[model samples]
Target chain A: MSAEAQTCPALDAKELDRLRGLCRQARIDLLRSIANAGAGHTGGAMSLVEIVTALYFRVMRVDPARPDWPERDRFILSKGHSSPGLYAALAARGYFPKERLSEFDVAGGMLQGHPDMLKTPGIDMSTGSLGQGLSVGIGMALAGRLKGLNVRVFVLAGDGEMQEGQVWEAAMYAGFHKVSRLVLIVDCNSIQLTGRTDETLSLAPLAGKLEAFGWRCVECDGHDLADLVPALERAVAVEDGPVCVIARTEKGHGVSFIANRVEWHAKAPTPEQLAQAIAELEGAK
Target chain B: MAETGLTYTVYDADHMTQAEIYGAVLTRLGGERPDIVALTADLAKSTKIGKFGEKYPERFFNVGIAEQNLFGVGAGLALAGFTPFISTFAVFTSLRAAEQVRTDICYQKLNCKIIATHSGVSFGQAGTTHHCTEDISVMRSFAGMTVIVPADGIETAKAVAACCDWEGPVYIRIGRGFEPRCYENDQYDFQIGKSIQMADGSDLTVIACGPSVQHAVEAAKVLKAEAGLSVRVLNMHTIKPIDKDAIISAVHDTRRIITAEDHSTIGGLGTSVAEVIAETGKSCLLRKLGIPDQFAIVGYPDDLYNHYKIDADGIIEAANAIMGTELEADEDWEDEF
Candidate 1:
């Protein structure tokens, strides 16, 4: 149990509406930053907007002022290439000035193409190479427990990145060890770098496989904040074993032409496309 | 032994291997520091890191058979503000999980120590898969990595304690079992990036690392007695941030240099010394004795050391060859490529 685990408070209608507003803006900001950088992982970052927003805004107990707080809940973007998504959330959450978002992958800039904990203030762990973040979260979780600190560690990984063998290695260790303070959110955004993940390497029975590996598995629509917030809270409540919330999402989630487009995996959106994306998000309530 | 600053150990120093001393030393340090943690990849017994596990089971993590996860978890533990000591075979730590070591630990500049046992061809009978002659090459290339090859169990103890205080990523490569001791005890100062002059002379210098230091010292003694040759033996334990001053001084004092190592002739102690010589533009005749660019054959470690000319007898032969050679005075370059 955590210091903040007294209650899984339900999200009020106004709160949900406000959070949805942040997620929509997060998508717009992340896309603009990617477009500004001239090269970035557009699709994956777009897919992760709500998941990252939910943690920074509602779920996790973190402070933008004290990024080094020992008792703060930790977050790791294991899908590090989707740094723009994380940066947007950090900016929206006031970790740093939102204007710094323009420098997203610029040479000599504070924000790197991947999440670097040393460089970025709010980043808990440096990650770019796939399949390393979960193990790092396990380390943080285990350390917190060892220190008797009531902290939680949340790791958001991509479906395509699951192809990496190291992911399962960490999964097995956490599951076997019953590290309950960790929550793994798999953003099942189907599309990978080349094509659909199912076409490339199917993890069709993904939930069953995770259950077999000894984790408490939960599934939900990653884009729906109401569903996702409750799923995350439920995951946080489980004290018996590690929890894996398989969040079904779509690559390039918000925009019309970019959604599920494989080429947008790492491609920068053109100026016209950015305008369209901004309009689509802003035009919504 | 009391003068060495290390407490008296129950384990017999003469009979025990470097890995055993490392395990004992780590177990002792775990008592002093609460932040210290140990990890292994199903090599707890083989690497002898299990000793620390037995002492502090709560701090120990056995990431069974997953070399990548072992390093990744070690990096993670390091991120959580605990100093993690990870152990595995030299081949796995330096080669199998190279990307994890490089990207996760070295690139991030994490305070994680890698105690890689069974380095070089020490596990000879285990075949080429277990043999790691390329570790020095691979580990030295990674940025922010400190590499050390202790000569014996005493030096291993000193190195293990020293690294606990040194920040950033460090790689300590040691042999599997019973390689003869080079030092009597840990009385001598063991500093990272500094070479220890075992026996001093001016005729020729033998720059060696790991178990090769013992062979070099013995060879120097034999060369002094029989051939009437004055030989200098330097235990170049640190590979990364190598002792450039020592190598440069050896070149200035003794114009002939013979580097011995239980690794490849390409990029171990031999190649590191060669880079120094090339950079200095000095006129020292250099000879490298090691495994001559091939997969080491299966045999006992001692037999393999002899077969590959990385033993005492091999150093004697190489010393003789260097003593008989003359340096070319001409500095004109030729494009051999």
Candidate 2:
């Protein structure tokens, strides 16, 4: 919480393991919230557990109590159906009570089915529709550069979300304007709501597309924070345009039956299914 | 103030393009306030923010031909403590960037200003796609939104200056060309939600906004001079948080009311005035004049206004039609008053 604490980014192996453990617990909480609400997106939430967890717990310089801290790094969940995942990370970081996870999608609760910055704390921009957050981040990054503020914007988007044409519009802006202090992390989970991403609309050679758009690309294991943290460091070090970290991951990472399954994109677990999934996660632990 | 090519001050604002006035004001604001910034979605030349772009090159951003991103990035800029003035065509902001304007700016209550140009049939030759008649409806529907349709160059300057420092999202719709001035000068007080009564007449009231305000004033003058009818004209520029007292005064004093705009008759100024007058349980014969249910006819803005009977002549005719059917409100509506 001091100036020295803000300067520190080196995570010991033990801290990394503890963060990983926190991610595992967040994943369980994501499932519990979705299951408790009786209907929600499970696959994308599970896919985003580690990347989001790493950003909140270790990467982003955000204090929960001061979510509006001007110097704090910003995060936007562009793929907003996965609110349970983002809520889990914000909860684990003490932005709100972890008990609020059970209230996901409950009418009149803090957690909506989608991310609403007005209703929920620690949500930088209220993003539900896809392909818009990157441009918003570009705006913030440009403002930060203009103000000479020690801040950066991180936008987490999905491969399916990239299908929207606005994403490329923002990419072109970021490239042409030479906006720095911004990182765009694409959750390259190979699946979407109705079908696999490649089957729906191919983003093959996504890195090449990003490169053409003037972004420096770094591919990493989305579920492995070790790969993500170092790649994020490289992204931060780049001084030119924005950086893109293409995180390769399955549709559902933690649980087996839901892994790479398109149908689980928005289906919640029953009580029995929750028990079975908890057993599988416990077994893996 | 900063090399504005015009000698027009607030006391003598005459014959300047509204967009030029906006550019001049922004150029001045950019010099005075470092937090003020300009953005356009490749409409710098057409929307007239190009002047500001040229003056303060570092403070202006052209995000290519993308309106949605223009709005989203405006919210982002506002979030990072900058006053972002995003300019584009009104059609794009109302339809293309509607979601971004709603979710990103209005929902979050960001301090962003949207300068939507070429509103209404002002882009008549460009056809319905370019013309924006639904912006007033869409912008007014959002809560915490300050919707302003400046009547002329003077009002546009005032509105731009007022919105640069005011909190929350503000959408100011302006026309393509020079609308005839409704005010002799910019000395009038420009508030966010208050109506400006240009003239007071007890026989009838004609409430209009944007391009229609000048015509309504011209009609009021003609009716007073030619027909011996006292037709009051109101420049109801701010649509959301509309002046209820003004409408009630119009209803109480003049039982005949006619609302006109350069927008759809359904959800724009006409409907807003009707709702206000109806809520008071007061009886008034009202003529809601604007573009009907069909798409606008292709022509110049003046020709289209005449064709749709919302021009000065048309407003005069509408006033004549409504003045005949005024019901007596002497003592029957005393309790409602």
Candidate 3:
């Protein structure tokens, strides 16, 4: 068990294996949900599975029973297009029934096209428009401090979403204020809706830009549990200022054909493709 | 301190602008309700929200000229169970960060109070960029958004305090400074979505908001004394969920209606009244007295108001013009489109 996992259940070897198995199932769950909906951001959602799994199952102090528990740590999925990933995580962690996962983007369903906090139980903030999650995280962090509550705010934003000017505005505010207990986890999938983020707008010196904004920057392999767990722990341990964990990841990480593919950014898989994708995921150790 | 427990007096009303009263009332409320918080986009001093910042240094957040993040943070705080009073210029709030106000706050229906200062041509000297003549139009269109344009300092204080009890999002527009006092005190019954009848008349009805209410009242008095024409002046403070009954009654009793506002005629107080009158299927000569579809030339706010024909003179002229027009004698509503 790593010392960092003490806040939740200890992340021992068995627990790690269990979480890895859960990640595999969550990816399958998300793929099926997206396929059923016939439209979703499959690439981005697949890329976020490991990170969302780590937060919900291991790091965040959230109780599925009491979704509005005041003292629980807050997690905001700023990259709201990848809601299937978050919905899968929440369902796996018992936030809602697993069968409800198929209702993504369905009219009158609790699950919206983007993360809606008012509808979804575990969602801390309603976010779909890019670059807004971080600022909202700052607000929640400040609120937690004002109320004298022991809480941490975590925001997961897509690397492409960092292109938005408001992201830097929030970064500047958080860095200047040294907003404590706020962690920004940037999923550097390197691909956006149009093409490679490098082609769209280069974020080459991504960590450097965050560093200049006064955030303590850390890099990690976003998919590797060993790397992701420690990086998140280090972020939670920071007391002086805001921290940014630049998780280097691939856009369509797991499935071979979908991996790093731009066309798959918002494409739902066909039934045959879904079966193949599930087989690939299930076959992985 | 009357029924609402707000402390704005006639003396304070004499010295303060609507924004100043808003700041004072917010700071006072901060002391009372621990859940209350204030936010600004580097506009604390200009918007008078700095008053709260000075008193509760920890509670007030200045987002450093980022209006988008300003409202975003305000929405976030509202999500965390805090009633956030976010302030910025009317231009920044209604236009610059309009989407954030719509998606992040109003879409979720967060408990956020947007105190937008320098609304309409209130900051007329700062040019068209700063003078927001479209806020009432933009904010009123949002679903579940409560829009209030207070007449003066006392009314501004009442609005600031009253919104704390109300849920969902509220946009309170006020002037920069030195708006003439409308009400002598806060004793008059003030409620959200309800209009206060400043004066009663039958010849013509002049509905106005913000500083225009005072002008309408003065114009009503002048018309009553000189021309022997009685004009009803309605302080249509709440733009959204506007006082429709009063407007309908005025349309029925007086066959003439004139809307005076310190805003563009496109989408504001005038347009709201026009919408009600149009739906009533009644025959009334409706004249809109406001800035007519053009960027206002930079000048003092009072001069701009007078030039744009939203002042007492403009209301009087509009009233006299409207009274001359003959109403359709046929009561058949089936043919009028």
| Among all candidates shown, the one with the greatest DockQ | 2
Clash pairs for candidate 2: none
Among residues 3 or more apart in sequence or in different chains, the pairs in candidate 1 whose N, CA or C atoms overlap within 3 Å are none
Write candidate 3's Cα lDDT for B1-337 as tens digits.
2224577889999988778888888888888888889999888899999999999999999989898899989988888899999999999999999999999999989999999999888888889899888899999999999999999999998888888998899999999988888886768888999999999999989899999999999999999998999888899999988999999888877868899888889889999999999898777788998888888899999999999888999888888777777766865644533
Worst lDDT window (10 residues) for model 2 chain B?
B1-10
Give model 3's DockQ, 2 decimals: 0.79
Per-candidate TM-score against the hidden true structure: 0.96, 0.96, 0.97
| Best of the candidates, TM-score | 3
DockQ score for model 2: 0.81
How would you encode candidate 1's per-residue C-alpha lDDT over B1-337 as one tens digit per residue? Answer: 2123454332445778989988988998888889999999999999999999999999999989988888888887788799999999999999889999998899889999999999999998999999999999899999999999998887888888889888899999999998788876656887889999999999999999998999999999999999999999999999988999999888877889999888999888899999998887767899999888898899999998898887889999988998899776544422110
| Every model's TM-score on chain B | 0.95, 0.95, 0.96
Report, to 2 decimal places, the DockQ of model 1.
0.73
Q: Which structure is stronger by DockQ: 1 or 3?
A: 3
Arrange candidates by DockQ, descending. 2, 3, 1
Provide the lDDT at B16 for model 2: 60
The residue-by-residue lDDT of candidate 2 on B1-337, one tens digit each, is 2223323464434656788788778887788788888999899999989888899998899988888889888888999889888899999998999988988889889988899899999999999899887889998998899899988888888888878767889999999987877777655788878999998999999999998999999999999999999888899989988988899989888888999999999899999999998898877899999999989989998999999888999999998888767476457765666
